[model samples]
Target: MRIRKVIPGDARPARSAPGGEEAARDPQFVEAIARGFTILEAFTTRDSMLGNQEIAERSGLPRPTISRLTHTLTRLGYLEYLPRFAKYQLGIAAVALGQLALANMAVRGVARPLMEALSQRLGASVSLGRRDRLSMLYVEHAQPASAVALQLGLGSRLPLAVTAMGRAYYAVAQAEERAAIDQQIEERFPERWARVRDALHEAVDMHAALGFTISIGDWNREVHAAGAAIILPDGGIAAFNCGAPAFMLDRDRVLREAGPGVSEMARRVLSIASGKG
Candidate 1:
């Protein structure tokens, strides 16, 4: 069977510059590099290995283009060709790049202790995340020593529409940025927008009113989470989230107990991040 094409409409909007007129006007933009990255991103946890045809379908590129790009990437050590399966998987270079990126982020070092302490105190999983395109990318994570926690790790990504971390980040974003993201979400997930739109607005309002947001089974049916955002001394915005299994943290408890605690923790973290603590 032919692999389903992963068209632009099937995925989140590009976090980079807008396409069409905006892209055409940018003379310094490199389309080849962007296309190469797109091809690399076609391999996922579920789709770990892909042939040139599958990569072409998933990246919305022509087969010939994918063939050339894949070969180039393989030569650069960004992808490894699997002879047995006749497919390609991420290479050690990708892991090295990701590790280097994480190693250089100062905020992760600054937030690790606080996240550890918070997770220990609350018996929940604590995560630090930043905006990656339209999703929240986990940069650092901590879990209680003795508790069973969510199996999230560095580089894990959650949706911007329903995750508490995503909402918290959105709430703190500038008006124009938020508007652009909102428009993109509406366009990307039109079928689900009506159901999620009102809840998203409510989350933003809650964050504005209470310094944090709560999500109970909104993103995942088995999880409950709360989040708040902080602006680092370097002016980068990041969100911290605490989450637990739905069986362990019900909706009322999240709103009544975890919500306030997470909010206060966020404020303290923000103070530390801003060098005011």
Candidate 2:
């Protein structure tokens, strides 16, 4: 689904995405290139290294195909192969591309200082991210010097079905966009969505009323966060969240402190991005 704009109480109406040839529907779609990218993406935060068999299982491609793709990706500098472990992880080329993309994001430059200030004040980590197909990919972040702080940062992916950031983005998504995401959720994570459906709906409504949403022990049982979203000048929603481990922040403190902190930072970001600040 195309991105949509959402703001508290005053967002402009969303427009439908212009018609374009989608991958599944396009005759000119390159399956081999897509498969290669899929192989690279199979490496997640949990599994930084994976052999051909592991990549095949995660990517749903044949072992021979994975071997070919891995070899090509490694040769092209997108994946680094470890000889002793006989495994592959993302390589410098991939890191270069990701850094290039993040470096060019104007909003991130405007958000980082705000995030750092908030993180310092709350002793929590503040992150700015946008939706990356079925996950929220942190593009920038700030963390306090707390021992209990989550170590996730740039390139880290959070589950889109249950995390506070994902919920806030879903809360702000235009109706048609939300419907598209709901369909994807059912298709990609049916049982997980079923379990969180009611709570998600409630959180969306709370975002409507309070300009923030909470996720206490939903994504990570030890992590607690409050989330809010901002509509960029290009009409895309960027999700930002603040939180720490359960030992550092209880539910009541998250509601009273982190909720408002994240919401205020989101507003500040929107203001700057819109040239109003």
Candidate 3:
């Protein structure tokens, strides 16, 4: 498989000074800008809303730093303010940027029509994502006729170890790349790594056998997910997944049906991505 060169803003290791040196490395708020993004990254698949104090505590940035960054982010339209509740949430501009990126991505166009068809057939939500360093970035997502559906917006980042989409992509990555991604995860999110590290071998075997991976509440409780990779022309992979609330999707039926459908759709999307379609 070919490794592509980095495009601007493609996720990479957050280069601060080696471990304890971060606070002492910069005189200006270069560290502050880094801290601001760190605070932003603290919001994730599990946690949505956070108070200033919560952000301060989570990011390890001072309370004043968190406050200034939150205020600036809110004013810049990247965050929303809830004055009464003293909480902050992602704002419209964040969603808009995500939508714009999805609109422009070549992989998204090739995967969209197929995802829609798959969603209709399975009556569940379908999602497409790519590995950005150790994270899975949502690139395309579709929902089926069921009353409730996962509403992950484009550009949302999910952990790559516990989630099916993450595992599928991880399985396709080259050994060195996989190790690097894993190392980054271990360093960045140690607690999460402890949970999924031992499961890697099993996940790899599952991908080799099924041509995809299935996750049940590994990332989100009561959420069931199945994922496969669209192999590009160069033998690289782009990841995609389908998710449904456990109550709506029978686990056995998904394993029997959705698994194959997602695998087949991924192959088709790969063909299209490679210009073979």
Candidate 4:
């Protein structure tokens, strides 16, 4: 099977203006820590075991820097080195940290039941996601009871430039943030940017007009999806999408039926999260 490629967006942490000014004045900011974390982040679910050169390519760090960071990370128990493959993978500490983060997120509990119900009703897969840097990170997923359903699961990350959930997120994002992300998309995906640009804008407009966004064979040629977003009481934005094979879920049906259902489900989830329902 040919695996689909998900182009990752720029995930470098933005420097805080105040902190940057302070660091410039104080000269105590540990740049090494940030670089080390960047090296660690280069390993993803798709690119789990990476050698120094691959790590350098993915993280945009120099080869020498990556070597040192990997060594340090391996020694610190944040990464494990595989001698046979000459690669490194995230260690137990990273798994523990991920588990801690997931345990603290209350939204999963609030949304899972509703997502399962919606998945069953529509015979599609329902997923809840949040913005993770420049990607939509799947936080929860529910699939229909049917034997055949999309297999996207929690921890799957999709590009912010093409996916329905990503477009819904862009629709709700602040204007300045959206502009920054758009510029990055244009720079990173110049070849495909022209094609995706129009579709992305259309999805945003559709979201504004219909309270949901639809994409048919845009992200993945075999899949069709619709998404809706809601702002939680804690001020974080979350999006839910329903997706299935394009042959099974036609565009018209998605726009007319699944779209509205997904949008209403998102609203109800938001209401419950905000203590209003």
Candidate 5:
């Protein structure tokens, strides 16, 4: 897995940076670092282990370049090379960094206790998360002791296009960011987007009207959830989601109880984060 050290002033054979034309004009944009992240992102929950060739195909980078980057990442503990399968998975260092990032989020500390009380009172699961690409990555959650259907816990990613949490984030995102997100999602899911596009907009409009959104059996056929977004101290959007099994919470409860509950939770989170509470 180890490779020779990258020499000083090494020449880049293919400087294929992403972000299309915008990234091309940026003088300060570093391709080497960006390429490493692209490789890291090539592995998903379903494809947790990937060989160099698979990494290249997913990242749209050259195979040789993928090998070099994977070797470097393996050495740096950002990727773990599994000789048994001739593939690689994210390593402990990457996990540590993700955990550290979540730990440093002051809002998690402020939100989790409130989320716990809400979960208990509502008899559902409450989560706090932020957008990670086209997904919502849960940083913290509280589940009621009576048992829940969803197995999602910390670090679980919920798709942005379908889930309540994702809709809340999209609802709160600026216009430019929303357009970019829409383009990426459409590119990745062209066939599905044709069917989902109108509904997604409807949800966004609902959020605008009510300050929260609902997703009933969208992400999972048996789950019902609602999400509300709040602006964080860093000007980023994080959402609070409350949900239970579809049988436990019908459409009415999701709109009446879950939706407003998440909205209130978001306001409380914003108040504490902004030092107004």
Candidate 6:
């Protein structure tokens, strides 16, 4: 295979620059992309629908900069400006991008069988995840064929401080990284952080002792989970987890039945990552 070098002055035909300068040389265009993403991120749980001023305040960009970014994003169909309410919201383009990304995950092929086997053997919800910042994005999930089952699927994102899998991942992280994650969680989600921080320290220590992390009703009420992490080549944490309704399975049962398989699968993934497969 031959590698093609990117010429410094190359430009894409669809989006032409004013001169023959390469796209990388345009600092103004770079800033525009940054400001646009910042504007989008400004709309969070606390402020879902935001006006230009709110977006500016949250993003720390000037009001005029936010207004221009919003206009560009709205024009690109990534944002919708509500003229009647004078607010901006995420539009269909974002949903379309999410759908496209999920479609490419190959969850059914790679993870479904493993999760199904784990679920049936343990009589629980077995989930595989890829960590994303403070969240765990589900790669696959398999639940028992019970009527009162959790409806989580491949695309669901679980908070790191709130889910067993998330804690397991954090426990496997280095001390410094875990501390940084802890600080961010405490700073960002202070309410939940206050309730869980002390227990989380104990949980981290317990994971070191027990070789896994367990949580009961941490993320979802009445949901019990035991989880372990698979350390990837780049030191990112992926996880395997099993959850059940509190009355259905206890921590001992989860560890005894589900822990081995999850850990074995994690080892297999790590081994493959290490080029041993």
- Candidate 2 residue lDDT tens string, 93-146: 998998889887899999989999999999898998899766788888897865
**Cα error, candidate 5, residue 83 (Å):** 3.9
Which lDDT tens digits does candidate 6 get at residues 1-277?
A: 4222211111111111112232355645555566566576555433457898777666677667677788889999989989888999888997698677767654334556666877787667788887766677776678766544555655566777778888888878888888888876776668878677876776688677876777777676667788888666665666878877767766677667666666665666566666786
Per-residue error (Å), model 5, residue 259? 1.2
Backbone clashes, each candidate:
0, 0, 0, 0, 0, 0
> All models: lDDT?
0.79, 0.81, 0.75, 0.80, 0.81, 0.68
Per-residue lDDT of model 1, residues 1-277, tens digit only: 3222221111332233224333576887777887888887777654678899877777777788889989999999999999999999999999899899889778788778888888888877889888977788888988776446676666677887788898899888888888888777777778887877787788889998988898888877888989888777777887988888888788887887677877887787778767788
lDDT of 4 by residue, 204-238 (tens): 79899999998787777878889998877887788
Query: TM-scores across all candidates?
Result: 0.84, 0.86, 0.74, 0.83, 0.80, 0.64
With a 3 Å backbone cut-off (N, CA, C), the pairs that clash in candidate 1 are: none
Q: Top model by TM-score, which number?
A: 2
- Which pairs of residues collide in model 6? none
By lDDT rank, best first, the candidates go 2, 5, 4, 1, 3, 6
lDDT of 3 by residue, 22-98 (tens): 45554554665676667677665556688988777676777787788999999988889888887988889877876
Clashing pairs in 4: none
Residue-level lDDT tens digits of model 5 in 1-277: 3222211111112223355543666778777788888887666555689898777777778888888999999999999989999999999989899888987898999998899988988888899888877778888988777644455677667778788888888888888998988887787679888766776788789998998999988877788899988878899888878988888889999999999988898899899999999
lDDT against true structure, model 2: 0.81
Supply the TM-score for candidate 6. 0.64
* Model 5 ranges off by over 4 Å: 1-32, 43-64, 84-86
